[model samples]
Target: MLLIIVGTACGAPDTTAAEGTPETLETFTTTADALTVQNCSPLPTSSVLASGDDGAGSVANNTRDDRLDTRWSALGKGVWIDYDLGSVQSLSGAAIAWHQGNTRVNTFTLYVSTDGVNYTQVYTGKSSGTTTAAETYTFATRTARRLRITVYGNTLNDWASIAEARVCGAPATGSSVVWRGDFETGNISQWTSTQMVSADRLQVISSPVRSGKYALKATVRQGDDPINSSGNRNELVKMTREAVGSEYYYRWSTMFASDFPSVKTWQLFTQWHHEGSSGSPPLEFYVYGEEIRLNIGGDPGTLVWKAPLVRGQWQDFILHVKWSPEASVGFVELYHNGQLVLPKRNIATMFPGMLNYLKVGLYRSDTVTQVGVVYHDGWIMARTLADVL
Candidate 1:
């Protein structure tokens, strides 16, 4: 009974077994995860131009520079700071980490605009006078290119000061976010473990980050294997241990090094490996020669999507999957570089009763002699497309 119960719990950690244990009446599966705080990475802004500033160091541009030590301060009640998203985008709110926020409340009004000249008021509120952390203020979703926040001095003084600010994006569809493996925690502590030759195999770097302050730089050399897997790898494992019938939307970004080897073989940067030890992962995103391909099924897998690989530039991907053994019930949808590249396709995503876990980094053929490096960022697993978006 104990062995059966353990095996039935999402296939356990056994991969050599031919079939996974079936779910019993007592077996429980989690379908959804906790909802996020609507704290989407601050929408990217092209340029920040403010109406005024207080001094040389407390300049208008400091608010969006991703730094809290710096601030944008101006004297007066109606002073404002504005931002241009570079292009029109779906906006839902604003997040502000106010200067001296722990001691005072700042009254503010949020506005949005498409042409920068015609602005529409979206929200008017007061900052919570308790913490200096970024506070997200949500409102009706709107499409705009510019965002302005006018502050009416805090309770303590007539100075409008903000340490950092960001425009939050509206969910394009859903909102139930499950987990985030993004390197926002300053390290790889969010992951379950690592499959690397050494500690330098996976480094959390702050520069060249897609969003927030940090990203993972995975480096793989020939014969590098910490888990003794088939291929050489330096991968970060995220043990989601997703169950059958579970659905998730995963959003992430990857950038290949400019000198990444272009050998005529498979080089996987992202994959969802099954519990078993051999064969290909049921679902994987790999670079074959000079092309990026998304494959479903194990050995001799079906190539569902493929594109010419571009190096030195970030590639954004959103993968929506229904975890099921039945081909008719499980499916995969992909959004690449902000466009729907692959529509939902009915297919088996899990192998029999086998469950799946996430692995990110560089995993490739062991025969290749050249070293490979890849940057991964913004790994978010959500129940809704909007949450990942």
Candidate 2:
């Protein structure tokens, strides 16, 4: 959800009425627009790990209260506050208003983590030290769950303070495991949007789960065109829109039902669809008769990898790709159930000038007579293999 943070000495601005959920950015506001801004949105923020607080007025909530007069102040150096985005996200930067920004500079470092155990430092610098107004700090885009700001005292003394702050989300490119569509929320709320005929087509179930407390049971019968699209599909989407030069690792598990249609046609379970929407996706994971296949390019794309399909058994996959339109620069790698099924192979991962987004569920040629069912869970996208593992 986008939130507008007005940098006036007054208070926060009146945001648009789209405060329904806390993720869809345009639903609120932005930071680059200096006059109106937000404390901790574009990415939702909730304190996860924090040092002791100074007092009641100086609580951690003050950092996001939309008021410059109130601050989250604490004594001594090395004090910090961490925010959990509820789910992994592609974070780009941070906007912070120091406790006494106009008077003193606060030395601080920015760190991020996936599981909240191991942290990686992303940015380190001092606040503007000139204005109590919020300052924006940019860094290389990264994928993670939590953001922590550690302060090492300001210019005045060993006192750490933050009037307001926020971690910004990069809706496009990222390196680490930035998101999960594992049905962890007991629903499909984690995804950017959906293309389902009905909620019943894509359901979250507790039993028959591969990991976590739930799994998605996607069902599709013939002629189920939820969005009145060309093909029959019931899918949940993650709008990655990964740019050229971007690389990422993805992990997920899927199981086809024993009664899944075995027609000698394409039944796509997952795909990185190009934005052009006119032809086959650049990359796709599908079932062709009794075999599972991974294809790259379009139409009659090159089949990079394939294996015999096994029904009623969880199939785990870790896919690594460098998203480039050039064959020499882009590549794809795959590991199935902990085995190196496909080594890194250079190829064009995207159509030139076109972006890609994720769709996972059951999409297939609608001519088949039998119903199709598939279970999916534990979907994660990261920059490194270790992060998804």
Quote each prediction's TM-score: 0.56, 0.58
Query: lDDT score of model 2?
Result: 0.75
For model 1, state the Cα shift of residue 178 in Å. Answer: 1.2
Residue-level lDDT tens digits of model 1 in 115-187: 9999999999999999887788988999999999999999999999998787877755555675788999999
Off by over 4 Å in 1: 1-175
Q: What would the per-residue lDDT of candidate 2 be over residues 5-46, giving only the tens digit for each residue?
A: 121111001122111112211222222222113321245464
Error of 1 at 266 (Å): 0.7
Error of 1 at 22 (Å): 26
* Candidate 2, number of clashes: 11
- Look at candidate 1 and give me any clashing residue pairs: 15-276
